[model samples]
Structures are given as C-alpha cells and as structure tokens.
Target: MNHVLENPVYSALRTGDSHLAFGTERIKYFNEEVSPYVGFAHDDANGFADLYELLPEGRRVLYAKPIPAVIPQGWQLQHEIKGLQFVYEGSKNIEGDFSNIVSLADEHVDEMIELVKLTKPGPFGKRTIDFGYYHGIFDKGKLVAMTGQRLHAENYTELSAVCTHPDHLGKGYASALMQHQLQIILNHGQHPFLHVRDDNDRAIAVYERLGFKVSRPMNFYFMKRL
Candidate 1:
C-alpha cells in the first residue's frame, strides 16, 4: 500500500458513509454496505471474493489482488491496508471557542473544494459532507482550516480530513477542529480513530501532541481487470 493509494482509501472511508460508498457499486460484508466502487462488483470474501461474485456472469474479476502488507496488526488480514489511530477515550474536553465553526452547504461546495486543494489534505469534494459533518474556520470571511469525520463501524468512527490552509498554518485551527470532532464522537458514544501516512512526520507529530497514538500502519491495493 503506497502512501498515495492508502491515503485516499482511508480518506474516502473517513469522509464517507459508514458502509463506504465509492462511485456507485456497494459492498456488503456480513450483510452491511461496507464499501462501494464505480466499476466493481459486490461480493463477500476475504480478499477479492466479493468483487468476483458481483461481476456480471462470465465476466472475470479484473482488479482482484491483495492489499499492501504494511497495515496495522489488528486489521492486517482484512485485505484493506488502511488501519486505525486511536485517541485516548477518557479525555474529551475541548479547550476553545467553537462558535465560529461553520457548516458547509450546497452553495459552499466550490469553496470547500478550493480549500481542500489549497490544503492538500486528502480526497474531498462536494459529496464528502454527505457522509459526515464538516466544520471550518473562517478568518474575516475566508475559510482557513477544517476537519470532519468518516467511516462508521459498530462502536467506532474515524476522525479525518483535518487540514489547515498554508497561510493560516500554526494558528491552532487544526487542534481546535480536532478537539471539536473528538467531542462530537464522544457524544455519540463512539471512539475516534484516524490514519496517516508513515512519512507524514509533521502531521504525525501534531496528532501525537494532541494525544493520538499510532495503533498500526495499514496498506491499500488497486485491482484492475487482467
């Protein structure tokens, strides 16, 4: 699972719905929509079984391969390399004013995309907000930083899409938004988790400073028809 692919997959999960909807194809594991794709089928197996089973009759599985090997221990065998990062559960206090947090709507979609482009955080678009809540920081009516949630399992949600504009970096917006999201997850009675590339030392450091610990490294794979 190279960092590029790994990051987007996890981002999609975190910023999308609990069942993970990609383009259109929906995947069900244990009778739940866990993942989706534009051109893939929906089957249920350890590796590529779901994919194969969902394909049209006589249409061979194209992108069916194992995920990368560098995943966290708890999810190493799941065929998806993305793993989870856990923030300590007990401490749920946020130390900042959240009145400035703004919710984005249809009219603000273009602005949100531009913000994501400037920050280079991860894959985010208009649909990203459809899955989870997104909050942003504004300085004099200009969007500067933002964070959101994604990927919902039984008792957990992935805290992700944390990014701040370069010009506004070091202004504590990331920390503030993170705290806000963490508190939201706690209110829902779920633990917060996230994933980061191993080479992103700076972001990792910041998360650590915020009391988040790396649970394990995950991997991702892309399978195409052969």
Candidate 2:
C-alpha cells in the first residue's frame, strides 16, 4: 500500500479532513467556498468522472500528484505547474514571538480574503480559514502578511497560503508568519511540508533557509470546464 505521505491531499480528504469533503467517499473534493482542490481514492477512470460531475461547470480547480497522461473527460487541462515539495528537516526548536500574530477567525474572514486577493496565494476562499490555524500580522490594524495550514494527512500537514501584501515586502513579515505556523504544526507533533512553484526561487530560498529540503518534484494540474 502506498503511504499517505505520497498523496497527502487525497489522503487528507479521505481521512483527517473528511468533514470538509464533498462527493462520494471514493472521490471527494473540498467545497467551492473553501478550496478548488480535489482528491480521489485512486486513478480509476470512474473516480475522475465523478469529480467532473461534482464540480461546477466552469470553475477551475487544482490537483497535484503523479497523475497519468490519460486525461479525464469533461475536464480540460488549463496548465501544468511545475513545483517542488519541501519537508522541514531541521529541529522543531525554531522560535519566534507570536504576540501580534492573531488567530484569523470569522470576523477576520473579509480581511483575509482581501489580503489573499492582493497577494495571490493559491486557492483561498472564505472558509479556507477553517482548515487549520492561520496566523496573521497586522500593521496599524491592517492585515499585511499571513501563513497557515492547508492539507492534513495523519501526522503530516501541508503549509500553504503563505503570502504578504506587496507593500509589506522586504520586511520579513511572511517569514515571521511562516515560523509561527511551522512551530505550531511542530508543537502538535505533525511534520510540516509545503509546495512552491519551481520558478519561485526567492520563496524556495526562504524555505530552504528555514530548513525545508526538497522532497520531490510536483506537477499541479489546473483544470477547468471543457
């Protein structure tokens, strides 16, 4: 049997995050309001078909895994994004002050969405904040930078939505938020991992500097209506 680590998103949908999933157990997805990511139990053709039916007619969605060349019907490939999955390999002793890093809640949802829109950090929705602990930095009462958890599989959690407002760049706000989230995941005894586009050399460097090693190459399939 393949380990859950190899297919964290799919595993997460079927396991730790089933409550957030839609569709049948064999092929589930996160609700449109939460994320545009989906998962299947396997590479079975019918399972893919089930997803095509589950998603709205024109909404684009994302899938990252070792998918075969044969494409499923009703879903056209938008593009293939090359990325690298990084796993933190250093000690969990990394420290940072969480004083101003507030827990993003319902009241902060609108602010979070606005920040995500400005920063363009993957597929964040109104409810993406529900996945796991999301920490943010506020400057003069404005949300400027944030990072948080996305996928969960057994003892592993995928760190995602790491972004900072363009105005806040060079201030290391993103780094601070990331360390805060990473430490939280570590404190809970779960391993921290993240995916970054291959072209994001700067972010990759930041992750590497923080002790995350490239564990594998990844292809993120962005799909849409045929």
lDDT (C-alpha, whole model) for all candidates = 0.56, 0.82
- The local distance difference test score of model 1 is 0.56
Q: What residue runs in model 1 are displaced by over 4 Å at the alpha carbon?
A: 1-26, 29-49, 52-84, 222-226
- Cα displacement (Å) at residue 97, model 1: 1.7
C-alpha lDDT (0 to 100) for residue 82 of candidate 2: 81
Q: List the residue pairs that clash in candidate 2.
A: none
lDDT winner among the candidates?
A: 2
Candidate 2: segments with Cα more than 4 A from true spot? 67-70
- Which tens-of-lDDT digit does each residue in 57-110 have in candidate 2? 887877777543455788899887788888888778978777888888889889
